[model samples]
Target: MSKVRIYTIAKELGIDNAEMLSILDDLGVSYKSVSSTIEEDTVELIKGIIAEGGSRAAQSGAGASTEAEAAQTSQTQTPQPQTQVQPEQVAQAPATAAPAADSGMTAEELAELAALEAEEAAEQAATAARAELPHRAPVVTIMGHVDHGKTSLLDYIRSSKVAAKEAGGITQHVGAFEAQTSRGKVVFIDTPGHEAFTTIRARGANVADIAIIVIAADDSLMPQTREAIAHAQAAGVPMLVAINKVDLPQADPERVKADLTTINLVPEDYGGDVITVPVSARTGEGVEDLLEYISLTAELEDLRADPKGKFGGVIIESRVDKQAGVLATVMVQEGTLKVGDFLVVGENYGKVKAMTDSAGKRIKDAGPSTPVQILGFSEAPSSGELVASASNEHEARELVAQRQEQRRDEEEARKKPRLSLDDILGPLSEAHTVNLILRADTQGSLEAIQGILAKKETDDVKLNVMLAGIGAPTEGDVLLASTADATILCFSVVPSGAVKKAAENKEIDLKSYRIIYEMIDEVDRLIKGNLEPVYEEQYLGRAEVRMVIRHPKTGNIAGSYVTDGLFKRGAKARVTRGKEVVFEGTVAGLKRFKDDVREVRQGLECGINLDWDEVQEGDVIEASEMVEVEQ
Candidate 1:
């Protein structure tokens, strides 16, 4: 290593930032800040100084050395660019005999130099791309606690009952709108306020020019409200506090302001730069002032994008619309998106047959900062992935293929996958081997995955691609994988009910993924002994209470309407009544029109029995299940 940041070194040694600074000061090492990088030799000296500090420091140093050794080992395992050097370069080396001082450095040193050059080139390319991109309208993200009037505020701006149309009158997914206010044209991203959609909120903040954190005046600061602020700060986006529900009798804006100071978000009135506006989403009071503030802030920031740069955007959400096939909502960040443009999104490629704005109005084209729903993809693209234009259909396909191949090759095998209980506890085979039966939606996807696995093959650890095909996994595949103790991986394809049941019975590991990166990542993490916990709550569905049935025998039967996702009979459930989780239990029973049911999709009505009597009208019921997953 040439140089490393002090914070990075501290992290490697599992020590606090302040402790690292203290140690550096004690050693008489000169550093501008924790972020300042020091030379490799200086770092070694610092390590030696720590080792001499006593036994406690010595033990820490020992642990840190082991960690450093492991990191170095992994780096050595990585294939070097020099290994793929062209024959012309090797032949030309002898021509420069005068410059070959002691035959120059070894292959390892040369490889490191090549890696550094490659990194610098990549950074320069990124800088050039950013400089060339044109600027567009300001993109603002709305974030806050559940039922804190985020949707209501947008509804007011758009002059529509958006909240009323949403499931449970709560936003379930991210939605973007281009608002042409009196002040200026600004794009707003409405992110789900529910805790389950924290990732989406973070994504929203990441893409936004400003974050308007909605805080309910009556509620002050809730858990999700605090989380929203943290996300905005982490994303480095300018924030404007919107204290909503100001019309409520119990509303107290002062309490919200007080809580803001605790989080280091002091308002302008409190001798801080943070701007706070009290608004009533229900009545639209003070909303005009909020818009003016956002517009002014956006103008001051001078956010820009080049409309002539390569067309690109981020997928806010993608789904299979039963009538329209694959539909993806993309917010154009640069260049221009047209109706007939062919685009590549991550590993999926598509042609834009049509483009519709947030209001479902069809349009010919969209510029930077404009959100549009595109139709005519081969399949639904992965959410939060990049979507950019290709020269043509053939070019789009080729581009996505190359991307998938590069992605798989770039991923580190032992650090990619989520940790299942089986992965963490299962004993490794005497022979280091990973057997797999792979299935994909397309031949290209299958080939891409196989190419990466081939590269992962080593003398010590054998990677066996036992079966690679295009389609959902069959019962036969499951049986063979079971007998061989191999894993079954499905990319963009799902196993049938029979196949799932067979795998369950045989205790075979079966995994499915919609994105190529996630599939490869999970496989990389499959190498046991290098695992991280991946137990996550997978959201199933959300529902709203239509009517509460006080059944004589069945406790409280919630006559609910499914809002978002689906509801399973035995799924883990939570009931929220106006920002508070009133009940957390299981979906003990489910029914449709008085008939017992196993599953219910969104936009449907069903009777749900939580085995709890506290079910009330207007309460939101969310269904989820804990499973091993990754980001």
Candidate 2:
């Protein structure tokens, strides 16, 4: 049966539209307006509520005449008077909005017209919401190669020694702080490097206004330097290159500028638009010119924000503090944030009980372009989570509930198995990951094998054929397979004596097939986790923790001495206490001599940070790296 519009139900019940809406709200039935349609079940439920003495301000159109008096009475009625409707009962509704039964139109058609009118009205309302306030400072993000003086540059700009606080004098995490420059106030985001910078740029969150690439004049362009420039290009933000460490004897600003030209970042001295400044973070040489250029860029960009706008910010960093609860450092992009205000962030809502500025000073409120730490979240919100303000606690709770429900629905959808190659290969799991290199005698054979591999790869277990070539197996193929730790799969191809010798020496698996079905069956078995591994772990170093030191900034770390070989950062680690393996994870961090180091040799003591933190004294931490070997 067709749904009945609200006006028709109101007319049949001998009540005004406003009174009908009041009953709907009191009954907790969601609705839009008089143009909205109600299901037959809902209509019966409403009637039952009214019959049971449901309370409303008015009934039978009483106490609502004055509100409807201003509406134009231009609608023609049909013989059925029950479908008659009055204007102004649905919040200044149009006069031509006759009930569905008399309007000779479907309920959907009426809703469409009402929605069109509402959209126009909403547009007008949005135009009126543009807030006017003081101008905002420009937020700058520093990005470049590691150890290229990104943190050092910020240190010089803020007149603070931030790098000295880090483990290896390298920024390990993303952070933002405001600075007072000669050209007005500016905010700087000291990120871990271009990786974090790219992550922040990839997010739609409004964060950075300018990107400053710190290039060491001595080191010139590094791999990460080009990567940082590429990220800045993709982000579409204006950039300035800070040729750092110019005070050194080997500093060559001209060479740096020449190298930058190859990447389209031509310097101003080269008659290009890109600006470059030679500066030393240590000596503070040419630093004033850099700040002046930043101010000039901000002025040219005309950065401004409305402090009274709807509160919105992006969480740049968040961590669980041992004392102050969850501390979330947020970059305020728009509007104002103050203590006692409720904020909703990704299924989590928190009342801001306190705020601290960049300088670690307490602040009452923060405006746009301000970085403030928010305390009071029961749990730490994720980085890059967007913040939304609510008028009160009730609204914030409602929003959180809605977001949580949505997240659960999304998770349920994700839990379903994806339709991919798994249908052919039974079911693929993470343990079934296989890497192969396809070598075939003919192009057609190569494509056929590739087709089989590409038919349907699963996310859990993927069939990665690094290279597909139509040729006999060669020494190069063996070398590549040895390097990538992959198996060589051959279809109608033979290997020479040299290639075989090389494969035997390197222990690279070589599977040759004369028939396609035989190959497919073997591949199915291989991808199903039946293949033997061609790589083995080579022990790098072993360390015994003699002491455990606790610190407020770095957390719990093991003070250990390398006994056998050496310990390396990012190497696969296994922590063993006596005979039981307590933790099997990567070495997250390693430090020696109060500085971060990549590797430490034997008979030397260093600090080890593992993913598993319950490390105790006398625990043996073994570091290992993967190496290709016989299957």
Candidate 3:
């Protein structure tokens, strides 16, 4: 019989070679070499060692006789050992568990147990992948007043020296980008800092891990800046102040820091741990340090994401590009996203045909913390929308439909009017039923309007401002008002052309006033039915009296030069004699020769008939549209 080596037994047992050797050593097996083979006799001896409860004495004098017999039998036809056990290992085999007295376990039971263990192991791996992905990114949104260098700062960061030469400058589209540093990566969202961006930021901040509030060092903190800080706080994300424009001569970092401290963002240099970096987007100074700090913060927070799970991301911004059709900047939050993967962004779903980074370079796949512009969406999604990818196109479509239904439900809930204090109280009370949909040009205006309206509530007619936000009035506002039977009010905000048309069609009564007090007063009067339509008069081209034709009964027909303003048939006419008013009456008829006309332009001669007066030579007729005053 040939000797079977320990290696052979270890290989058969599915255990490591080293562990097999360790087991032999513990059993006090005498071996000539590591490579020594175990023969038939050796197998019998090892089985004896096992039966002896792994005792070192089991291989002594008494076992030597049994071993000799086994060696003799080995020379003939090999006898099957009583138990198939390797040398130097004496323990009850895991496969041979004690069975119940009534029945013994079958081979199928062992195989079933192994299968169950394998399934559990697979489940654990999947669970670990899910557990590793971070829920959100350190979303740093650039914000400040309009034209205050918010976009410029973002451009500087994107075009940093570390960026590849092939990478273009900061993308105009609002999406997130990763600034890679020596330590780690920091994600920065390029958002508009104007009042319109507030809505964008509020949505972005919802999933933010951190916020970077960019303030011009020269200007300190403006009203919008304060509002941004409050928004970041309200989102519950830690903030890092980036005092930009440090290269400018008027830049005052210290003053900016002082101003920020009042808002509770004390700089680290000012004895506070809140990181404040003095940067110059123009000079590209201190950007590295800023990125390093951001990376360090992220490291401390242990940001990580699972690349083996389902993909989820956020839509930074979306727009219809002339060339690309619809483009979206998506910040991938988790899992691997590859080209051709089916994805659903809000209510839209599509197979990803192309993926591009902020620099517009096409890529095959994007992992966690990657901000890529994805192509092939079924439709363009709105900014700040949540996106997720499924296993296949069908799943993606189903998910999109589910999301659309959910959004419809949410919108319906928002449109449902609630009972205000005025609704609960009698109309005789001082409270006025002020129902308005407020829009503003800036966040400050929106906040101010909401604050004032909130405070002006009364027991009888409480201010029932339906919605207040920063941006031009949208069609959604018009539709919401039309459904809720509410009026739309705008403060320093222009209604979009579509919204204007919708408002007119719905008779929703859209009002825009610049003065805050005037707006409040108009709303107050409107609730009380004391408000009326206000109009302004406009001047049209006028005509000079050229030739007169007397009529028997009708007024005298005067031929005149159509000059300066438009001549309306029923407009009030004033005959001015060298800046002195001579006659005041309505223009009964206006015509070019025998043709009766509603208006005539300058340099054209026209015949005009007055209601109760006659025109003289060199008479200057001033035409004006009369407007009624509102009380």
Candidate 4:
């Protein structure tokens, strides 16, 4: 049977689409949006819910919408006339099956389309087997402030000296390990505690089922400690506090508990749900209790994944080894990962040549919540990327090829001209913009830098970070910088002497910094003083708001009439109420009626959605474009 959309079913029952969507969410049904197709079984399940007196709303209790309750009652007692199924009610099939145009597509486009089909197929298969999967282990992550004994605690649990092996006695990398507790097996992820590793720690929380926050008893709560708590809470993961260094002479668990209460993490002993355990990683005190608490929490969560279907997981860490080639530490989330299985990780494909557990023992297979070092990736996979086991080597290779093609297409799309040759030779203008290329040694550093640079903008001066990537600055970077009249900024990455010489020959500025503070300082200076203005923003159009439509997946899409000039998709827009600027962001999407267009002429109606922080119905949207000019 062809899948029917949730909105169609809602229309048939004479209920609001949003109400039905909430019902599906309460029933634990997976859906991307109301337009998403539902299986035949799911359709029957909804009918059964209506047939059973529709008590699901009451069971949800407090804050239940009375209108929704009436709608459910009407669904059961009265049968509305059948509505005609709309063309959009049918889920569109994979685009790969659509014949290419007469001109045919490039190999890259074909590969990307094929990869999308494969991924959609995999998702459907995983959903089919989801209901039958048994409960799996819960993955827990440890996060805290620097020198708060996070690694030391993991070492005590695993009986290994990982802390001693770390550089500068601080955890710099995210590590995953499994421990056989008396209650059961619990997987643990150790995340770095430094402020610079914020992205890594957030990724850790995102993938874990539970979080253990370590706070030194002697020091109480620190700034990073608060940040770690915020990350775990933002991920919606349950957290348990581990007060470490309690064996110290100055250790005070009560003082730490008071600080935790201030952050809204009241201890269970203090009449709250947050569980706080006192322990000393140095002496192993209260460590067993901590393990027991973790097992109990996992039992309550009832975490599970299919062990009989296609294997899938996420890459926690990856590095290139001289002898082992590309080794990746992967934590399996669903199904069973066995030796010799063909796998696609990010843009890399490989056959599993060997699997070693955290203890260095060769394992034949791994199930959910198991972290193992696997050898065989063709290249180093990125951390936090999803990994799926394909049916065979051919399928894995095709998937990887498709992903690589998609990446290339995205890079090409983002390759706007930083500065054309003619523009560079022209005189200065009013709009001062500094174009830059950023290269970093790691993903974490790149993310940190991007976040920092995004906030370095002024009314007249704009810091446009054209490209950011991992690895050292290369000749290609120098060429791009020379063409765009942009500078090459490197963080913790040194360019080869030959590349530096090439940059010097081209008279392109190349700067490198080991410290984030120093890099930010230099970028600020360049944006404020060194960069010359070449263009100024000119008003392209103004639109009067007509209506606002809230899309489930795309947020708010505005319906407006172009009052003057022309409205375009790529133009920058600012929302104003009266004379005050409410928001300033890009026009991320635009449409005319049902069809999408590049631009709408004056006195035309169109739909627009901004990348702005917020949008209201009556806000006036003023669009502008930067126009080049000579002084």
Task: Give the alpha-carbon lDDT of every model.
Answer: 0.76, 0.77, 0.68, 0.76
Tens digits of per-residue lDDT for model 3, 31-120: 533334456665565556555644656557678998999888886777554542222222223444554223354334444555677799
TM-scores vs. true structure, each candidate = 0.44, 0.45, 0.46, 0.46
Which parts of model 2 are misplaced by more than 4 Å?
Answer: 1-133, 160-174, 409-631
Clash number by candidate, in order: 9, 2, 23, 0
Point out the higher-scoring one by lDDT: 3 or 4.
Answer: 4
TM-score of 3: 0.46
lDDT of 1 by residue, 145-199 (tens): 8889988898788663222333344332336877777756888776544231334
Model 4 over residues 1-631: C-alpha lDDT tens digits? 7888666687687765666777798889876545456888888888787766457566566446766888899989998875432223223333454444442654345556667877999999977676466878788888888899998998798673222333344322336777777666888875444221233332332468888899999999885576567556545678889999999999999999988886567776576667888999999999987886787667656678777767878887788888768888888887889999998866768889999876666789998888888888888877667788888988887888898999898878668646775466445556677888888999799889988887888766787665566788767567556545688899999999999998998789999999998999998888756346458899999998888888887888888999999888889998998889988888888898888899998899998989553677788999999986653
Q: Report how far residue 93 has shifted in candidate 2, in Å.
A: 25
Root-mean-square deviation of candidate 1:
28.8
For residue 320, give model 4's deviation from the true position in Å.
3.1
lDDT of 4 at 425: 44
